[model samples]
Target: MSQNVTFDDRDQSVLNYSPGWFLTGTYNATSVGQTGTLASSSITNVNVTFVFPTPATEFFYFGIKRCCGGSYLICIDCDPNDRKFITIDAVDPTDDGQSPPVVLFSQKFSVAGVHEVILMNQPDPAFGGNSQITLDRFELTVPDPNAVQPTSATSANLFSTPTPSSTAGPELVGSASSSSSNLAPILGGVLGGLVILLIIVGIWLLVRRRSRRTLYSEEQATAPGPQFQSQWRPNSTFTTLTTPGTTISTTTSRRELDAGRIYSTYTESADDPLPPEYGQVFNTAGPSESSSLEPPPPPLPLKASR
Candidate 1:
């Protein structure tokens, strides 16, 4: 049967149906049906209802269960165009042989005032069955705008305050400066060690040159005099004194003392001539002048030549 019930903002109602055929469309099932199938084998009826209000978004649900039936019954849903009306698989109850059935449908329609909605037998063509569905109770409620949902807890309602900078403190800046200052001593120590090494090497070279000069002086003092003259080895590679006609063998140990003063004494050889200063001493082979056998001369009076 087809039925209709109009609803507004404040009012609510329920529709009643019976076992015999009638013409009713959509209405509310807020209350129990009066004259439909009760919990017994004598009647099997089906009830459907619809509701309309001001256009709004809403949710809908329904309940179906057996009041009483001898057979194991079901409430299966089927496509509207199928021939055989199918019921869902039923569970047999041991206590009262009653099984509860539930079918729920929902849709949102945008229309202003009273609008017509349809509720059908679903897969019904021949339209009458002893096994029935009964209307219990339903809800058509509107949600409030101000009501909080679960998402509100984690949402960012507004911008959060910015966190302070990590390096804002002066103590952190001071610590960095102090770290660089601590490295200064280590850098200075390394540079100081390199300078000291250079100075030590320079001092060692000066000491070594002085020691060589002292050794050369000692060697010159211990050398033989010109009476027992032996040729001295040349210390350096170059020669200084040269005679006009004679090829003179070079002497090494003689050094210039001052102007017109030489630390050298000459020895005459038969092969080479001597200078004029050593003329009497050069070839006096017997009883040379101022021999050791000659007497000492008388002492003269001392006078200052002024």
Candidate 2:
């Protein structure tokens, strides 16, 4: 069961309850208690606050009614900081003379952060009794009129008009493919240039190696530089270079000698003896020198004796 709000015995602190919109009421109840009631001839007002924590762009729905058999006006007290309000008139009834219980109103009101919506009564000048007004339910919601929908703009009622489409044709697919193919030639040219650079570097290395070999052959031919000739010659002598302060030591090789023989025989007979005529020529005196001088002395002696 839904609860009912009644102003049974609420003493009039001021002329009216300054704030708070009436959510649910039976305003014609004539009860009096600590909880005050709204009457048909009594005048009261409803206050509302429109709040948005973020920058919200939505429409709002509010419902209102009157139990009395007269017209009533819902006046909105705009934000004094910013003048903005909505006025709804509950002036007519249904064919059965029943006033509309719930009416939804929405607008494209862009609110920044937070804003308050105040609902106040437009005190009518004709009636003087404590007349009454009632509120059922109020809500601020994004407009979604249909529960199940494929597209919001499209309606199940075919009588309603339709919105137009926003897309183009399939030629865009071919154009995108052609644009990608045009880039392939540029990529191939870059790869071909890199291959040519590698070929050039490889040929340069081959030429350098050939030139190095040619220089090495030229050095080799200019001087046969000592062919390693190993013709064995016995009893050859060569000077052995020694350090300035040291003698070059020749290692004596040992040879096993026959027990009865000696090495002196080999050294003495190894060379022929000098010729005896070389010594006789230097020792002989000449015979002609003494004979000539002695013959002249003998002739003089013979003359002197005769």
Candidate 3:
């Protein structure tokens, strides 16, 4: 079954993307894409997939290099069978060179050079956004021979993979990585993931029914009467945080709710290292709502400065 809808230009809030292809391609964003192509489709149940070969190493990053408009679901080899996708929004409207590769999906394997990347248009209808996605470029992090490989999954695999602008992969030693290639580990992982997903779905459905019943009541409670409304808003603040070698600059909105309770709101924005998981929401209003959903495109050549 398909919606058969065509040619929709949706705002960041209500996500709905066009369609692309399984083309093998690459892109370099000067300040947004200059030499790349975009895919537009009219079907609601299709995926625009892209594939490329990556050399074996201890670490690698797969991101959309172009900073344009689209949302995509990135996966390693065939993890979880695409039943659920972690989407990265590539709808950044800013060209300040501060944002690209909107969201980064970095995963550490039991062994390197043993997996592949498959990107597709978001398949979850619950995402409630456009169905289109794009991939202009991919960034990879070849392992550093001088550093010991991380063995534990807890070891930060996220931003821990970014390299300085002058970084390069270690010289090829041998074909040992290829000789030891095995699928047992990845296959086991996929099975375990499916089990966990079933548990989550059961819990989620129970919660979903409750949430719907209380949805109207919660909305009604959030509205404050004239007497309870507070006109005073705390000054929004900007802060820059540095971890290891990466610097994250963030802006937070502190607002006084109706009962004089102050809460800080955080959303996806430029300078943030990671994108939020879809469906997570805060008490967003006015400017914050729009900014969170459209923070640059994901899957870019991550340029890190030392």
Candidate 4:
């Protein structure tokens, strides 16, 4: 499916020459887009532009009539800058009136795209002011539209031939940008995972603290405390409710009086005053409650007999 598209110098659409060009050659075989700018003011070169179709071409070849020709520059998708162009010069011998058309300049490109090949007519530096050239025609290796394309795997393994391009830094810059894009999501995932772990730890600590406080409260409520016991009997013989040597609160002593008696082993004389500890108890007691504490009424004497 490889094909060649040839453009004769007569084709005005392909080659754009500056002010010094004159049409002076046969049809389609050889022509002139050359300029004698050694002593001229016009500073532009001849440019051949090609618009490659869908399946682009990979190489170009230019046939020129070379006797005293200078150099042709190859620039792909770039403006004419003499500082950055591929130089292609044909051999120039000393005495030459005319010569056959030879491939003076040819180049192959790695990437297929729009290309601009410029031909600047500077006389050979060796023969300053004595160099000249004749433009014949150019050919482009284009692919057929119905050509069978390579499979994906085959394309991946295919390496485009190295080209004389000076625009190499942009590719490396693009690679660095893609690497940065890939790292962004990984960093975000790490940060998100750390935040989730912190929340879980906080919740666990809160639950542990509340559980400790609840257990402490339950223990305090069920602990042992003070105790009290009592038995009430109205109109009975006075009896001591508190154990010997044990102290009784005033509230308990008054409750005993309400049941009709308050007993104490503090009697020293029949008319002696009560002890200070018992003074409040007797002073507040009713006469019936006080008399219940006295010895039981003597048995009534029998009527005059034994």
Candidate of highest TM-score:
4
> Which parts of model 4 have CA positions greater than 4 angstroms off?
27-55, 79-83, 94-98, 152-306
TM-score for each candidate, following the candidate numbering: 0.24, 0.38, 0.28, 0.38
Query: How would the candidate models be sorted by TM-score, starting from the highest?
Result: 4, 2, 3, 1
Off by over 4 Å in 1: 1-47, 52-60, 67-117, 120-128, 140-142, 148-306
| 231-293 per-residue lDDT for model 3 (tens digits) | 554675555766786788865564444322222355668886776644344333343343233
Report how far residue 23 has shifted in candidate 4, in Å.
Answer: 2.5
In the range 1-306, model 4's lDDT, one tens digit per residue, is 677777766666756666675446432322343332111111226444444433345555544434554555556556535447666675465425333455766667665556665565554565454444456666777766577667744675554443545676877567658879999999999999999999999999999999999999999999988776656645344333354566333222222324334544444666767554554444324543433434434333223221
Write the candidate numbers in order of decreasing lDDT: 4, 3, 2, 1
Q: What is the alpha-carbon lDDT for the whole of candidate 3?
A: 0.47
Worst 10 residues of 2 by lDDT: 297-306
* Tens-place lDDT digits, model 2, residues 191-248: 9999999999999999999999999999988966666978655543333435667645
lDDT of each: 0.41, 0.42, 0.47, 0.55
Q: How far is 242's C-alpha from truth in model 1 (Å)?
A: 99
Indicate the residue-level lDDT of 64 in model 3.
Answer: 45
lDDT score, candidate 4? 0.55
Better of 2 and 3 by TM-score: 2
